[model samples]
Every structure is written in C-alpha cells, then in structure tokens.
Target: MYGGGYVFCEPDVHGQPDDPERLAEFEARIDRGEKIEPQDWMPYEYRRQLIRLIEQHAHSEIMGALPEGAWITRAPGFKRKLALIAKVQDEVGHAQLLYSAAETLGKSRADMVNDLLSGKSKYSNVFNYPAKTWADVTVIGFLIDAAAIVNQVANSKGSYGPYCRALERICYEESFHLKQGYDAFVALATGTKRQREMLQDAINRWYRPIIHFFGPPDNESVHSKQLMRWKVKMASNDEMRNQFLDAYVPKVLELGLTFPDPELRKDPQTGRWHYGDPDWAEFYRVINGDGPCNAERLSARRLAEENGRWIRQAIMNPQQKFTIPFA
Candidate 1:
C-alpha cells in the first residue's frame, strides 16, 4: 500500500508553452481519449513529469514494503507470517514493473535509484513513520492498501499507455492484497480486549497519516497543470481522498472503529467529507525527508544496495547499453 505523491511546481503548473502546432496535435489526441505511447512525440515537460511520477511510484512500492516487512518474523502465527512474506514479495515485484514503465520515458532504473538515495527523488510520505505493533501492520495493510487502490484504479485509465497498462495489472493483483489486509483487520477487530486496544491505538496513530495519504487539498498542493490536461493525473487529491472517505469510513464505523478526528464526517448537503486539519505542514516535512523513519528507511535501502554491489558488478556488461523495454 503506497501513499500518494506530489510533484514540485512545474513551469508554475501551467507549463511552458510547447511548439504551437505539435502542442495542438498532442492535446487534440488527448482530448479524443487516445493513449500516449512511449515512441510518440511528446512535450519535454510531459516526458519529465511522467518520468518523475512513475519513478517515484516505483520507489514507493518497495519502500512501502518496509514498514510491514519489519513485522513478518513477529507475526502472530505461521499463516500470517507466510502471508506477510508473500505480500512483501508482491510489493517488490510491483516496483520492478513500475521501473520498467518509467524507463519508457528515458530514465534508467540505476539513475532512479541514485536519485532516491541522494534525496533528489521522493516516495510516499506516510511510509516515513514507524509501524509500532502488529495492529499497526494490519492498519497499514488494510487502510493504506485501500487508499492505494483508490488512486491506482483511477490511474489505470490514464493517457500514458504503458503506465495505464501497468496499473491495470497492478490494480488486479492489489485486490488480493486488500482482501488479506481486511482479513487481518477483521480478525483483530473481533479479537480479545488487548487485541482490540492494539487495533484502536494503531488506528489513532495512523489516522493523520492516512488523512495525509492522498496529499494536501488541491489548492494548497503543487503539481503540473499539463499532467491533468494530458490525463496523466486521473483525479485531484481532494477527489481521491473524498472517494476513499466515502467508501472506507463506513467500513471502519461498521467495525466499531474510529478515526482520531471528530470532524471527519460526510456532509449530507454537499456530498463531501469534512475533515479537520491533518497538518499539511507535517505532510510536507515528512515528504521532504525529516520524518521519524526517513533516515532508517534509507539506511536499510542503502545497506541493501551496498550488500548487493558485488553481485551487480559480476553480472555487469560494460559494453551493453540499456534498451527500453518493448510492450
């Protein structure tokens, strides 16, 4: 379950004007709901934004595995342990698929990894927090994966053909992940007093981060307008977040669970959710790499990179250049 991402300002989010005729043609195709292929001509801004979005998404998938992976050995039973292991594997595989999709826009996986390690790239902000207990793992599995499905399902219909196709498969596989997560969640919600307490506490701690998951409200957010115009972003942050609340809030309520916010409710009149401030300041700070687990997460990844360097070198063919994967 990966949290959502925000792009930094791009040409002020309006984008710098491209060549007039080509821009018209590109936009006309998008207006007709045509998919944009990797080999097709595109504005430099479109390519840059897509690369950043997909590469960061790839990074998030594996990184998102970490918080839950820490609980694998300590899982309550052999069955749960096996499930966590399989889920972790699925998350890593998702990363490989996303990296290949990003590569279509011309960034190498190596370069993407370097940018991540150097702090030039970002992943989901919610993952920078620690998973404090088994209940916390369940919260991440159910709530976070639920949130990811909302975002990913929407993006499955996006204009970038490779990214759209990748998301289609991803969204399909994610159903099992969501089901397993909900299974774990329901088990705890119906368990003994201490188990129930653990679940509630996990929900309390995760509520704000979960609220922060879809990112800040649209007006307070930064993104390229051209991406939305080109269908690269299928929904606004507010739209997706509201959709999550509309669907999942009742599920939580049905389990006698609650979010920390008292103001989190749906408006009958406007058909929108009203949520208290979740502290966008914290969201920005976390995304900028100052969160509780940011350093630890990166340290773990860096350790893996170092430990595997020799194997990479042994397999390297210096004369070979990367060829973009064919669909």
Candidate 2:
C-alpha cells in the first residue's frame, strides 16, 4: 500500500535562508512546472517538509506490511499464500525506495529509521488498527490501497523530482495490489453466508479508519498554503476523501456492502460527499500511539531493528576485507 496521505504540518519558516536570487529562480522553476532535484536550490522549509513527508511515507510502508504480513502464514491456500507474500514484499521494497528518496533531501536512512523507532516521527494512522481476520486483509488491500492511490497519484504530480518518480513506480505496482484485493473481496462477497458476514464485518470495522486515512478535514488540518504553492501537497485531504468516495462507494454498494456511516451520500449540486464526522478525536488519539496495535507494531519494528544490527555491523566492518568471486 502507499504510505502517507501527504498530511503536512506547518513548516518552520524561520530557518536559514537560501540566496534570495537563487530562491526566486527556484520558485520560478516550480511555477513553470519544473522538477526540483536534490542538489537544486530550495527553501529550507521545503526541504524540511519534504523530508518529514517522505520519511513518514517510508516508515508507513514497512509498518503497513506488518499487519498483513501476519496473515501470510495463515493464508487459506497456496495461491493466496504466494500472492500475499509477493504483495507484502512489494510493500517492503516500496519502503526502501522511499527511504532512498528521502535521503536525497540530506537525512540519512538510518536517521529516519531511528526517528521512527524513537517515536520522534509517525507513519499512517490507518496501520495502527488491527487486521482481525482474513477479510480484513481484503478490506485493507482493496479499500485502503484504493485510498492510498488517490493520494499518491495526486502527489506524483508534485514538484519534487526523485520523490515523484518513486511515487510513479509505486503507484504502478499498487494498482496490481488493488486488483488482487478486489478479487479476494469479490470472492468473499459472493461466497457462503459466513464469508459475506465476515466481509461485512470487516468493512464496518474499517470504514472509519479508511475515512481517517486521508488525515483531518482541510479546514482543521495544520498544513500551510506554502506547501500547496510549492506543489508539495497537490490535493486537500477532503478533496481526496471525496474522490475516493465518488469512485468506490457505488462499487461497494453494488457488492451489497454498507459503510458504517449512515449519512454518506453525494450532494446533487455540489457533487461532493457529505457524511457524518469520522471522529477526529479518535484520529488524534490513534496518531498519538493509543491505537489497538500501536504498541505491538512498534515492538515488532524495534525487535527487527535490534536483531538486524549484527548484519549491518558485519557489512560495514572495515577490518574484514573481501574479494568478489566469479561464478
């Protein structure tokens, strides 16, 4: 699944200044739809904000893999088991690509990883909820991945060069994930009564978090207009959420599934979705490390890091010299 919803906070604008002349050129470049490379002139705020967004995205991909990863061993058949493993592998690979993209902005991958482990940063809040059943995996693969594509496809148009390129590839791979997920979801929806019930339960359970996935409503978000001006944020959270609903709600209804939100509907004149509030209080709480699986997720990540230290040490050891052998 794609990582962040591109939920930005207000960037600190008081940092060191770039040359005023160079900065004007950079802004002009962005205005003219040019991509900003890593070594190119950029405002300090732009770099800081991009680092935060990309780092969170990288962290989200790996952490997002975990909940689904747990289901791999228990996947019902060989076909599913293989597909699930490949999907999870893609998610992890996305993290590597994203971290490398983030590194171009000057933060080391190690620093970002350390920040994630130390709780100095955050990933997507959607992953903090548990995947309680196999049907839940389908929900994540279908609905969650669908929501991510909306956000990512928008961000892919942003001015950042490497990050946008990385997103382009990631979005391509995620389309297949959506197909696999939708196939699984359709199977469950059309199968036995028990299967249908499981799918419904999963949908109900995930509806709120899916709504929360894109971050707060635009009016309440801490994001700055400067980010939008820089093309760092290509779409508002509310806009993306509406786009997801317009695209998916009918499909979901066609499957005989209902969202937990009773008031969900599109306005005739405005063509925008109107729904009850998704409980922003819960969103903030989950983001602050109070969600059902937050501790378990972080513990698993920490343990993995600790266990992998020896391999990193061995790879970096200056005292151990080795020569490549021909096959």
Candidate 3:
C-alpha cells in the first residue's frame, strides 16, 4: 500500500508465463497490494504503454511552461511575478520527476527530449493555446492546475511505483498552485471593475482549453482500452473532466465569473453539472499544431535550445571545448 489507502500492483507478463495457471496467479498477485519494481518481469506492452503515457506527461510539463512563462515579466506586482516564476519552476521540476519515472522504463531521458523537440511526440493540447493577458495566467493556474489535480489524484494509485510516488509529490505542489490561483481569482473578483472584467475574460478564454485538457471521451478511442486495462490511467477522460466540472463550476459562479456555456446547469436529481459540449474540432486543430501561439511557443523553445546548444556540448565534452579570446 502507498500513501495510506492506494495499492501499486505488478503488471502481469503476457505470453511469457509458463501456463494459464501461472498467469492467473500473477494477476491474482497484482490484485493484492504488491508493488511493481523495475527489475520485475512485465509484459512488453505494459512497458510500452507506460512509456507512452509518462513520456507524454513529461513533455506536457515541459511545454506547459510556455503559456504562462510568457506572462512572467508582465505580472502586475512583484509578489505575483515571483509566484509565477516559482510556479513555472515547479512545473519544470515536475518534468524532471516524470522524465525520471519514464527512464525507469528502460529508455534514456535524452532520447525522450529529442523526440519531443523534434515533433515526434505529443504533449497536452492545453499548452498550445495563448496566455493573452495577466489575467490569463491566473486562469491557467486555476483551471489547468485544477484539471491536472484531478488526473494526478487518480494517477497517485498507479501500478508503477516510481510514477505513483512522483505523482504524490506532484499533487502536493499542485495543490499549492491551485490555492495561489484561487487567491488571485478572489482578489481580482473583489477588486476594481477593470480587474473583474479582465478576470472574466480570462475565464472565458481558458475554460474551453481546460475542458479539452481531459481529451476526448473514453468510448472506443485508440489506446483507451490498453491504457485502462493496464492500469496506466485510473479514470476515464470524460469521468475526470466531469469531476473537474463538479468541483469548479460552483466556485466560478461564486466569484461572479460565467463559464462561457449558456446551457450549463446542475441537475437537481443526479447532482451532475451539464453544459453544452465543447468544440472537439478546435481541440483537434490545437493538438494538430494549429493553436494561436503554437508557432511562437515552439520557436521560443527551439531558439532557447539552439542558443544553449554550445553549453550542453561543452558540459558533455569538456576536453573538446572551444577556447575564446578575452572579450
């Protein structure tokens, strides 16, 4: 058992088991609370599935900084600026943790980073959008962080020991992120008329992206069954999305911010919030590299990499370093 209530299980190896009875015994052992260590035998598919999910998660954390990183210098006050800086730093730390987790699955971090930078991998769709204003940063902290909390909370019980432990640490940090944004939203809501207006506009812009962050519904989508059956994901995308709506919509209304959905309302009988569906086409477009700031974000990342390439080379190969004359 981990973190008091959840269990991490060893994945049953497929086909390599000696017999059907052995496979059943292995699965039965998993049904218990045993933890899956790195050296333990696991199905090839299980390793591949986890690599896919955790690598995407790491990439998301790294690229996720771009949207809010743009607003760091523009924060309204020194305190807010510092907070955003720390928050973005924490996101970078999350990337390190997740990438390390993925490394335990028999791949190198350098390879994963190369795949992400070269566009051979996908990150979260939410990061592709633009953070247009200072208010947009607050909204991102609140909504995006909140959605991640739901997913991370579910992942805290993951079968992989390292991933689950990393998620536990990440969840604690994310809670603080959520609270900081909540405080910011409350301050703006009670501030002058202009502040309120800006906050509302930010809410309008980020709501759809946050909703889409959960990805498409969990019907017959690709990778759904494999991920779910292998316990890589503990909750369905739509289920987690609904859980986010359940927690956040009322808080948004309490702050006098509209959710940008006219048909949104709570069902008296079932206690579930219902709203008009989001535009999946826009979600596809954004994930397909067509969002408002996709080009700018990628260019910034690429330029940073290129400008720092020499330093990386120097570190890896100190004897081959260039000798420059005094400036």
Candidate 4:
C-alpha cells in the first residue's frame, strides 16, 4: 500500500523569481481548478515539490512490494500464493505508472532510482519494519492498504493531471487488494486459537508503524501551507490519520482484535480521535535509514538492479531491433 502522504525531508528551495505576468497567469489557472501540465509555466518550487512527491511515491511502490513479495513462496496455499504474486505485480505496475507521471516533470527513471539507491530519497517507512509472519502480510494488506486509499483518494482530486490520473487508477486496484486482505484477516481471526493469536500478535507489532505511516501530527510536520494552496498536498497528516482511525478502528474491534495504543479513542464531543504520540523519534530514525530492514531492503533493490542491468542495456541499445518469436 502507499505509505503516508508526502513526508520526505523538505529540499532547500532555491526559489527563483517568476515573471510576474506568467506567475499571475499560472496562479490564476490553478485557482480556477485547472490541472497543471508539464509544458505549462509554473513556479520553480512547484515543479521541485511535485518531482519530489511523485518520485518518492514511485519509489515507495517498488520498495513496498519487497516485504509482501517475500511471502509469495511461503503463502499457506496455492490460492494465496497466486494472489500474493498478482498483488505484488500490481505494485510493480504502480511504480511504472508513478515513474512515468514523474517523468513528465523532467526527471528520468534512472535519476530517481539512483536517488533511492543513494539514500537521498525515502520510501514509505512502513517497509522498513519486517513482516515476520503471514499474519503481518494480511495486516499490511488490509489496514495499510486502507490507509493508502484514504491518502490516494484525496490526492486523486489534487492538481497535476498525470499524477492524479494515476492515483485514480491505483485506488481502484487497491480496493481489490483490500478485499483479499480482509478475507485473509477474517479467516485468521476466526480460525484456530493459534491463528487468532498470530493475527493479534501481528496487529500489535504493526499498529505503531501504521500510526507512523501517516507521518507526524500536523502541528509538528514540516509541510508547508503553500503546498495545500497549490493542491499538491491534499490533506494534513492528522486529518488523514483521524479519518483512517474513524473508519477502521471499529472494524478492527468488531473482529475481536485490539490496538496497541490503549489511549486510542474517538472524542464524542468534537468527533475526533485521541491517541498518544506514535514516537516521532522512531519515525525520524527509520526515515534516516536506521530501521530494522532498511539496509536489507536497499540491498535487495540494489542487487535486483545489478542483476537486471543487462536487460536495461539491451533495451537501450540503438542497434537492437524488436522481435516476436513463436514458441
């Protein structure tokens, strides 16, 4: 699932002055609710932020696949194995879509990949934690996917036509993934005692990370008001997190499970959820590349890139001609 909304370390804005007439026109266009296209005149910061947001999202999709992809071979049955593989394939497709969308802003896929490899760009921190059991996969697929839907659905309505369009399609496929996850989750919840225990254990381990997934509270986040005005960032981290808890907490409790946060509760008066801080220090540490699986995830990605070098070389070769072969 897509991790939190755009929660990267903010790049230093080397803000350049735009031509006043062009800037006014561009702002007016955005104000009129028009999608920003690549060829359109825009402020440098807008382009920089869009590239950063989209590139991080694209990287997340690929890295997000790693934890779940590792489970395909060990899935409890053939049906689950096939489903996991298909789900993983969908995630890879999402990466391609997001990369293409970001490419419209002038960064190449190679540049983005290099940034990811060099630790200059960050992926969803959720993937930095290990998925220790099959139950963990189910929780990730269900709750994490649900959270992503909330974020993606909001972004789908934002400016930037290509990224919005990509999110629209992504949210559709994620609905199916959620169903698959829910079915698996329910089976475990209602299964033998051991299965139920396993599911609960997974939930306990993942709850903190899930809370962190949405990034820090709005008051603490470095997100800028200008991003919201530009429609680049559709919602605050707190708003999305509250929406997620409102929708999912009841469902989780209904299944006879519990959240790790005892203080988690909805305020009856104001209609907001209250919970303890999800350890922002841990979030920062993980984002800075100190999480349990960060090195492993990056190593795996690097190895895959190395192993696939020949294919990329062949595809880029000028003299190579496309061919169709009969089996």
Best by lDDT: 2
lDDT of 4 by residue, 1-327 (tens): 684656644645556777989888988888999998877778787888888888888999999999999999899998888888999999999998898888888887778899998888988999999999999999988999999889888889888988888898898899889999998999899999999999999999999998988888786434567788888888889899999999999988998889888899999999999998788899989988999999999999999999999998877978765332110
Model 1: lowest-lDDT 10 consecutive positions: 3-12
- Candidate 3 structure quality by residue, lDDT tens digits, 1-327: 001111122445552434556446545555685656676666566677687778888888888888878888888888888888999999989998888888888778878888887877778877778888878888888877888888888987867888888898899888778988888878888899999999998888887887688877667645566556556668877788788889988888987778788988878898766767888889888777888877776788788789999988777855563332111
Model 1 C-alpha lDDT per residue in residues 85-125, reported as the tens digit of each score: 99999899889889999999888888999998877889988
Cα lDDT of all candidates, in order? 0.87, 0.88, 0.76, 0.87
* Model 1 misplaced regions, further than 4 Å: 12-17, 220-224
Candidate number with greatest TM-score = 1
Better of 1 and 2 by lDDT: 2
Error of 1 at 8 (Å): 4.0
lDDT of 2 at 88: 97
For all predictions, the C-alpha RMSD in Å is 1.9, 3.8, 7.0, 4.1
Cα deviation at 43, candidate 2, in Å, is 0.3
Cα miss at 146, model 1 (Å)? 0.5
Q: For model 4, what is the error of residue 37's alpha carbon versus the real structure, in angstroms, after optimal superposition? A: 0.9
Model 4 regions lying over 4 Å from their true place: 8-13, 220-223, 319-327
Clashes of 4: 0
TM-score per candidate: 0.95, 0.94, 0.88, 0.94
